[model samples]
Target chain A: GAGVSQTPSNKVTEKGKYVELRCDPISGHTALYWYRQSLGQGPEFLIYFQGTGAADDSGLPNDRFFAVRPEGSVSTLKIQRTERGDSAVYLCASSFGLGADTQYFGPGTRLTVL
Target chain B: TQLLEQSPQFLSIQEGENLTVYCNSSSVFSSLQWYRQEPGEGPVLLVTVVTGGEVKKLKRLTFQFGDARKDSSLHITAAQPGDTGLYLCAGALRSNDYKLSFGAGTTVTVRA
Candidate 1:
């Protein structure tokens, strides 16, 4: 792909419902990341992938959140039992390398869990 | 926990005026990056400063990294209405770490 692409640009769901946001990173991008940005706040690191496996999932808030990049090119963020506080914009970024390189971000998916 | 704090959470000025936004943190960073975001759009990278005491210029925008690598600033010369947007600062906790810690951001509005 020309750039990082995210799916379901907007998702609205009720509390307790599960939601999944997808990201399609640039071709051959080995590093994928997921972040959450709330109103009036910067993007917070949610998870990071070095390849097909998660190298750093420390940023995940709790067990309810999970992300996976099966092929190292596309990723998915899953939220179980969504809550109102889960409302925010989820951002996906990809870089050619794990360090020192700039990250290209997608348009983001706005999730509103009512 | 490492954190970046941006000052003057909101700034509004008339066109042609100059403005500066600061990002401060207690911990040092291997690299710091600045981004500008508009409403309904993702943040766009403006510049990245890696070494301490480094300065870079992009047209009217100037970025400076502190000597201690714990702070950075973004200065705009002859600001325009187009410069109005949310400015963010992101830093890495460790050398070559992919994870970034970002500041809450500074919102600037330049009146036409």
Candidate 2:
């Protein structure tokens, strides 16, 4: 079985630009999550979707960050007016259900905002 | 807000050595997960401890959850070079099990 995967393994954009990162979760999985990881730091939660709706977005740093998981399988993390501070590795993961379920991750998309 | 703090942010040891990493938090969680991540890759789940004072083992790795559910520890027995990587602890709050708060992580370097 194939694992979770992310597109645009690497992305470089100038400040104030917009970028979208994509994620493809495992087949039949109903939950998807997005996280941002800075250098030498663990991944920070961003947003999570259960089915087609976002169950939680509290972890999103600000209004500039938004994510959508339409169709209940694929998701996208969108950053508007990106800042230099926004540069980091964007990770996507999925689980079979909810709490206590093992989360499988993707290779991640490294976004560099210069 | 629940915050998980991992101890010994960095560790280096020779192969065959034994090591333990700790994760502590003031807030209690319904479940805790341990993950190992290699450079340029996303984290891979090692184990998940849900019941308080429960212990789970994965080959040479051992995981323990505190009785209060506010802490956990990962211990490696006869560590090997393959065990080297960044170890992270993430906790799921009881109220919001879908949201996971991760620790800063501990980088382990096991030399052959």
Candidate 3:
């Protein structure tokens, strides 16, 4: 009955540093997704994983962004050489499996690249 | 790239008033969803409509999907102060079931 959750609710790092955001999906959820939300904007898709494999990463803004769901139930979003422009709220969501299923969200991790 | 545009990006109204928010896109989607998010929290799914021209209701909230599957609308009746928050529309493209394209969102503030 637990909902999705993200760790390090807030992170602040230097522009040239690296940061990793973590997500814990609902129990038994086979699909997970990562998204980024800028202030006053809706969340933008980043990547999706189905059973530990990234099914789609097209939404990733660039090579600096990467995500992995190694065990299928948990995921990590990694940002390399972060830029000040990369500052935003990183959101994670998960679903039971496919198509029409509702993707529940996590509280999100706010990353500030100083 | 699919884009969902939400109109009247900001709305403020008194309690007990009725309001409607719209989401439109040029690209057709297989399904569309509405979510409500408050400050310091993640979005919570309100409803999902998969069939063209489909309509679903959640208590005081009503949602409609366009016949062409390219748009949707959310209407709230007799809204209360508790109804205030950000309304977001997300669409799942025909090409990918796992990915969602979200609108910029409409921020609603219902005053008592």
**Backbone clash count, each prediction separately:** 0, 0, 0
**lDDT, model 3, position A68:** 86
lDDT of 2 by residue, B1-112 (tens): 3399999999999999999999999999999999999998899989888899999999999999999999999999999999999999999887447777899999999999
Native-to-model Cα distance after best TM-score fit, residue A20 in candidate 2, in Å: 0.9
Q: Model 2 off-target regions past 4 Å?
A: none
Model 1 interface CAPRI class: medium
lDDT of 3 by residue, A1-114 (tens): 499999999999999999999999999999898999999889998888889899889989999998987777889999999999999999999999875578999999999999
Error of 3 at B97 (Å): 1.3
Q: Which candidate model has the greater TM-score, 1 or 2?
A: 1
The candidates score, on chain A by TM-score, as follows 0.97, 0.98, 0.97
Clashing pairs in 3: none
Question: Against the true two-chain complex, what DockQ does each candidate achieve?
Answer: 0.80, 0.68, 0.67
Clashing pairs in 2: none
Candidate 2 Cα deviation (angstroms), residue B24: 0.8
Distance from true location, Cα of B1 in model 2, Å:
8.4
TM-score of 3: 0.95
DockQ ranking from best to worst?
A: 1, 2, 3
Each model's lDDT: 0.93, 0.92, 0.91
